[model samples]
Target: MLSLRPGSSGSLAPESSGAVIHPSAKCLIKRSIDILGALVGLVLLGLVAGPIAIAIRLDSPGPIFYAQTRYGLKGKPFTIWKFRSMVQNADLLKQTVSNQAQGLIFKNENDPRITRVGRVLRKTSLDEFPQFWNVLRGDMSLVGTRPPTEDEVSHYSSHHWRRLDVKPGITGQWQISGRSAIRDFEEIVHLDLHYQDIWSPWYDLQVIVKTITILLDRRGAY
Candidate 1:
């Protein structure tokens, strides 16, 4: 469980750390790991991706991949990619449906937009594989906070904006902890800010390990 620290004005500090370090060095180290890890993961998964792409095409009528605009470091916008896991018109359909999760996040276990293949991809988290390319491109890190969608960003308070102080990530504390199970927007913001406050190369490693375990268990994955 994450322990929250109190920031000025009753805002949550989000993460625990014993000391502060130079932000530049931290950025360099984190980027180096992202590049190295992404390169290696791509190499190892290269063979696997081809068949997965074919399966997706066979299972769905749309493109094999999907991309959406998301907020990255310092609130910059970038396109984040994933395997197409819903009907081509899913976004257009969302407005007509009732959302299942609380606060600014939307999650419905019974969402009708999910394609047949999308269910498997989401369960295994294979949909997120393309983001390694984003990591390589420096639009993201291997670990930090999950990038918020533009709609989600629009709802952020000033305290929540603190999450943008670091690059968005492929996985982070919230992911490893409970992911979609976390319904409160403030809790998600707290997790992101926590990651920023205590970030380090070692912390990245820890989060990655936890991510692997969470993925294997397939817990809290929609």
Candidate 2:
């Protein structure tokens, strides 16, 4: 299993993931762009949040948002927020259903826990709006790697933990490539670490552009 140690300030210490992810000037540029994009998203959220919340309430008996613990930069824990797209007891129901995906991840294309409104929220990616708050709060980047749940992290081999060297993202290569259709978890790690290796402001912009295209086309998204 991967090892992690908390920074003195209670954040992730730089060396926690067993590799030094050198901070670059381009990284700072990427951070600036993230802030701008997140601010716009939060403003948009203010307009759509009420309607989405009401729809969720009418379709399901659960909280408007689902906040789950996930590992962010350097395997640090953070709660990722999304519009509730599953039943209240969805987490508890995980083990009862056999996983349909490969390599330690649980995925079911037809998971019964999904709500009526949830299906729409997921396909159009509206369930991702709440994560703008996380981006604004600096818990995530606008583009990077996907965040993994603590349970998923717990099972990661040390090499797999390298993906956590950078901040997680609301959209990335994985989402744009195959999104929920991806089966092998290794494919995801490959793309994420590939991003880590070739990360640049231009690349991030490219990924963001492709992500918009994917959202509009609703390709491969659940």
Candidate 3:
């Protein structure tokens, strides 16, 4: 089990002073797969990025990409980029919207901030394409825990910090296991910890396959 405490910088680190303790944190095979998979994903993103950009531009008046700070491994902050899927002032208007999900995370199935094009992007999971760059840059893995916002982690309990033991992922157990339907943050944490408990290259491959299947069936992302 990994024990974590908040760092002075607001990040989480191992409670004991030593090399990183998470098994996946030091796995060369996983890193190699992250790199290879990210490369392929980036190529696919490039093929569709133009069309997506055009649609976003025509449907909304904002930058094609939206970048926001998200917590990565050990609660470290990094900029997460996605195709802009909301109005220009979506972040500013967040407080006005009610959070439908329970616990720390926030979600609204009918969020008014989402533009028409944004809905399609989100439905297809194309909005998440740019994170491939994060994977290539080592800020994220192809499969890991869902990256939390700084606000969400602000209220995290010590045990909740354990999920950050691995790098934040583009898709993970939470995503594959009915993400939109799972309203409780603790359940998501359980799945995150479960992934760490079962960290294996084969398991990551399985998750990748499942994610693809969900996307193909149009059953992922809302």
lDDT (10s digit) by residue, model 1, range 24-51: 2256777788999899867756866898
Candidate 2: where are CA atoms >4 Å away? 3-19, 22-26
The C-alpha lDDT values of all candidates are 0.78, 0.84, 0.89
Candidate 3 residues 54-94, lDDT tens each? 99999989999999999887678788999999999999999
Evaluation by TM-score, superior candidate among 1 and 3:
3
Which one is best on lDDT? 3
TM-score of model 2 vs. true structure:
0.92
Candidate 3 steric clashes = 0
RMSD of 2: 2.2
Off by over 4 Å in 3: 1-20
Against the true structure, candidate 1 has what lDDT? 0.78
lDDT of 3: 0.89
In candidate 2, position 86 carries an lDDT of 94
